[model samples]
Target: MHIHKLPDDVLHGILQHSCYFQYPDFYKWKRLLLLLSICKRWRHLAIPLVYNRVYLSYYDQSEDTSIVDDEPVETIKGAKTKTNLDLFVINNCASLARYADIRILFTSNAFKGLNQTIERMKSVLKTWSGIKTLSLTLVNDVYFVEHQVTAELYDAAQINQLTKELYNLIPGILNLRLKGSRLDRTNKHLYGKLAGYYNNQLKQLSSRHAIGLSDNIYFAQISKLDILLNSENGYKLSQMCTTSLVHLNIRGVPVNYRWASFKTNNDVEQIVFPHLKTFNISYLSSTPSVDRTGTELYNNGRLKIHFPVLTKLHLWSPLGHCELLASAIFPEKMDTFDVLGSSKTMQVLSNMRIPQVKKLYLNVASTTSNIRHATLQLINKILENSPGSKKNKLIIHEDSIQIDPAVIEWSQLTLLHIGAQINMDIALKVIAKLPNVDELTFYNFVAENIPEEAFALKNTSGCHNKLEALNSSITKLMLGHNELGHSKDAVITVIKYLSVRLESLSLFGAQVAFDTDMSEFVNDYSHIYPNLTNVTFRLLTAKVL
Candidate 1:
């Protein structure tokens, strides 16, 4: 059947599927144009899909006199040289009017014609009456303009002017993201002029700096705000809070009490964010003495701030600082806590009471053997406090040591992922503990630590007896690493020892002869596991039976 002849609904569905979740780029736009040229009906059906999101950029070569006179070509790379974004948008204004999201990127070379470019962009934006999202990026080096004639000075002015123009053009923008840019004093003044203009429209805003959200702009409707703050601007958060803010992500900012200072005992003064649900703070560098002082103040009630509705807290800081923050701000409602730092961070959690955390992820970066042992003890302490009703999920990665079975509540865990190296004895002990584990994944496995006593049972009846004692309920098992010298025997022994009926088995980096090892295993497969049905081998050079 001809594609155009299909029902209109079907054709629309096909077009939607073709560009679903695709990044709007030059190639994607060209592909859509090709489809539009297929037939009039296809064009009519695909118009909305193509114009839903638009990407426009300005690449000025006026500084390069050699290329100023070159004719603009329509080729992929040549398109930038052949046409200015302003002219391109003017020509395709009809299509752009249907766009809901627009991304504009200005190259460093484009500073010469920035005013004209901004005017053109404003003209195009004026046509999109229903635009909801706008992303503006200025690619240039950082510099403050102080009566300078450098190219960067002009570039900064151009960016500031562009943002001002956009503020007037799209007052109802819901989602705005600005990158590789900074908002100068002039831009902040312009933003102040539009304070209440976006108070009810903007829902999410992200920027590289906090200056973009000057004191003038009210975030009454903003729910999510992501910003990268340096030490100089980090204190701005004390004034940026809104009652409606739910999620705030601050990265590359130094930790200090100034961020959430209180002036009085009133709720408004004590709690800047009344309904914040999630708070993510990542420090750029660790200052132990400073952090210690901050934590001490917070614990002693000198630095008081409240997050009544906060449930999910993610923290990435120095080794000792993370635990201090965790202890100071013990959110009773927190159900998920993710900590990323050295083993010392986990060690401090051993003494804390975090009973509400059901999903814990500890990304440790410890090399010393003593810290690893401390980390193990911390894990055990956390598991002991977790509620039995909650199905816990644990993920340990990056330089983590072998998990001791005594620390885990096997029946309470639903998912366990280990992305570190562990020997066969430890692996067996882990399996024996996870009696109710639904899925298990191991990144690197080593059988070199098998005890001589266990190896001596190779031809004895007691071998299977010891293996059968493991009470694993794992339905999916993934084995990774190929360091096992007795690869064939280890596979046989593991399958024989764990009496649980596995539904799926995957071998990663497995080295075994297909004809000799696999054939023998297949012959006894039904006797060993009558319920086993699926098997997969990945990164394995040896063939499978």
Candidate 2:
């Protein structure tokens, strides 16, 4: 039936339904071809829709032949046996390559018909002019012989030439991921060429290159860059700039320049990212060649130099350099500052001018009882440093690590996280002052930690009722590493008001209850919060028990 013959309204509905999802297969094309075989009018309606999507795969295998009788022998060198798999894909999918996308992969037979295979891929890429996405993947290993004198060398030369040609064809590609170790040499040269053809609108570029001492691939064009490099040559590529780049993350160790260290000032040479909004950096420890201790050493490269528009900074560094880093990036007006590991640097870190920083995460462990002094210093510094009246968060490692309440002005601090142990009066007063306080987390809990007064107040004045009076936004809570003891009644009473507004609750424990009835409790609470998405209960029990 001709689509034009249908009523105009009916045709519009058909077109809308057809446009719902991008059909990336040749089913539409095959249907059109069948319609053409039927009659002229049907063919006209199907042809235009058929032209929308083209899918193609090319292989060298003959349709009639089976590998059961003749398996190509693996060779170190020679004519280079090729499998029939490559032939099958190519011959079958050749016509479909023009409409949707073109995907190419090497078969065991690729070596046997190297020249023909290269011609086929080049043809597929060229003929598919309408294609927007193209994928080239290396599935299996291809062996090459280092023959003293043979035609095999000539074939190897052809393969290299073909690889170079393919490299030049890839810059126009939108999403690209190149895997395998053998292709590194070809890829490095390819990356150098691609740096020139960078698209300003490029979305994702993930490249895993050899860990060496040189900066070869340019990340200046990629908006989202994920690089896994060998530790030895990791941080050497700091010069490239994509000023418009919004998110930046580097994962690798620093290549120390020790001999020239003190003699020259190691400040960042140029600011590459002025529009950067979020930044995360961590060292890759799994690379076999890297010395764990060596990578931890302080280097000028550890400091973040290119951040003015940054709003969130998530950093994981050891205890020592935390303060030094905070001082270096003091100019950034961050909304969130998260530091991981023992926060020995808190005293120095909190002193830096971070008036714009509202959420400060001191996610760290302390061995000494001196935590109170350090916490006080950090709070005092934060109050003195920040310019204005913005509420903030101060998450101490645990509640037992006593902090002087007077050092921090609870009036301006909206959120608090600490160890489970708390003085009932102090806790209530602190909760009262932060009217906007929304989220609270208690780490390392114990049942004995809850005072008798809290239980009595829950029954009498309903302290849980006062908690209910707090702003509705105060809906999420995390109690990590649970230590619930004998008092289930008291615990349940305290949680009543909080659970009413709570959207999420996470519990981690060795033994939550002697009764093993927590699952029943969780299922009952699941229906209470209308907006609740998840409730997690993680029990840590010994295998023997």
Candidate 3:
């Protein structure tokens, strides 16, 4: 029967059987063997086992491919044949998969002539028009062919011709990952030709070309983009700005400059991605590559580039020269924001005008003894800077962190988390302040940390019932453990008043996403907290251990 005629469930079964999981497992091996079998049994067997997923490699355990270095296509005089050859070949007698991986390993003169080899490879590649995701790798090796020291891989003209041929073979390819070699000899021509062949089916693209992701592929229709940032690029971000882009990931080691010694701020006017939503900037190296100081990224108020629709921004561990990158693009205003960065890194953004946000997470990372002080100070700065978002429901991200409720807008906060450094007086003050909190989490919640005002009275007055006077609107409460360990009884005593109005509470655990609208984050983390249904709604006092 024709492929489209297959029932939906049967087609899904075919895809499930052909998909490649971790390496080549039993199912993959069986499928490969069944593909090679020429008996009548093959008549009833599914053809998708071979055509649904394909991995063509030369330096692998399966598949046959050759790699060569071609810079304008040069030929060394007098090729020698004295070299050890390692080979793996899989002939493609039929067309293959929705996902295809081709790793070309160029060998010595032992392989067929360039013309013959490329023709053969092209023939095999021609059958894979169904591929939606394709990963292409080119491997160049230097060998002693009779001590000639040959590094010649293949003719560039031939490879370019092959790439042109591949246009028809993989026209439906949507996701393309290119590594080791540039796909186009003329660069833009081949990429543009491929884009035309696929009819803009390619939405996501990544490259590890020798020069990085610079000047490799150009297609304005691209929705997701990954850029290789280095000192050489020095922040001409306009080249990457496309109105269709929804996500952007920038990362790379400095090619010729160290961030510690390099001083160059981004050209703020060079970026204006109008429809972009998520922007991430980080480094891919062993050394910590953050800018030397906040001043390094400051442009002295030159031009303000804006991302009109940007919502999610994440700056991971190390940023070589991409520090405060969002500040360059997300200038004065943006709606529905999610920002994650250090206190020092975020200090400059304290005045960003965010009218509203769906989620806001701050790491407040520090190596000092007063992390609580830094965390509180940063939170206050953010709340002061973002008046519009002070009333928006949001979720916070941090494995373990503290908070100061002094500057917070109580009614808008859906989640409240405090650390060991909080005073009992301040903790009780939070209960009185939170008139609309849906969830509350406390880490290192020991009684000694609470001031006497919570359980004591004036020397001349009666015992103050401050704990019972609490009016918290919290629905879910989570009590987390501390690194140094805390007295359980002390924690129970402190949370009893806060839990008075809780609908469901989980002790010694945290649900980072609570019950808010960030469904993706919440769904994965909802199971982290222990049994909440079993917990009786009685004031968490003298609670079952």
TM-scores, each model vs. reference: 0.69, 0.54, 0.54
Best to worst by lDDT, what's the order?
A: 1, 3, 2
Sliding window of 10 residues with minimal summed lDDT for model 2 = 255-264
Candidate numbers, best TM-score first, in rank order? 1, 2, 3
Model 2 accuracy (lDDT, Cα): 0.44
* Highest lDDT against the true fold, candidate: 1
Better of 1 and 3 by lDDT: 1
Collision count for each candidate, in order: 1, 22, 10
Show pairs that collide, candidate 3: 51-97, 64-89, 64-90, 66-105, 66-106, 67-105, 67-106, 68-153, 424-450, 424-451
Q: Which tens-of-lDDT digit does each residue in 293-388 have in candidate 2?
A: 322223444534446677877765543235235424534467877665444556656655663676765554442356544665556565556645
Which 10 consecutive residues of model 3 have the lowest summed lDDT?
A: 80-89
Q: RMSD in angstroms, all models?
A: 7.1, 10.0, 12.2
lDDT of 1 by residue, 1-545 (tens): 97657888988898888866634354455566566677788877776676656555545342223234444422222223223344336446434433333322333333333344445546555545555776654443223322232322434455556555656665557876655444433323223333335545778876664443444545667789776653433334434545778898877655443443222233422444577888887765655223333222245444445566777778776434552354344557576767676666766666666637656655555434677665666666666766642556666665457676776554566777776777767887787777777777776665466544444334444233332334555666555555446566665454333322343343322433332233333344444444433443332444321
The positional error of residue 482 in candidate 2, measured at the CA in angstroms, is 3.8
| Candidate 3 lDDT tens digits, 1-545 | 97757776786576556544744232354445554354433423444554455544443212222324421121222221111011112433345457656544543332223233334445445455666886765543433132332333334465456566676566677887755433322222233334345434668876544222233334557788665543323422223326678987766544122221121236433445677888775544445344433223334444344567777776553222234543355634454454444444455456455445545544433323344346555566665566665433433344344545565554556666554455456666666667767666555344456544423322222333422334655666665433145454444435433332233443333222122122332233223322233343323323221
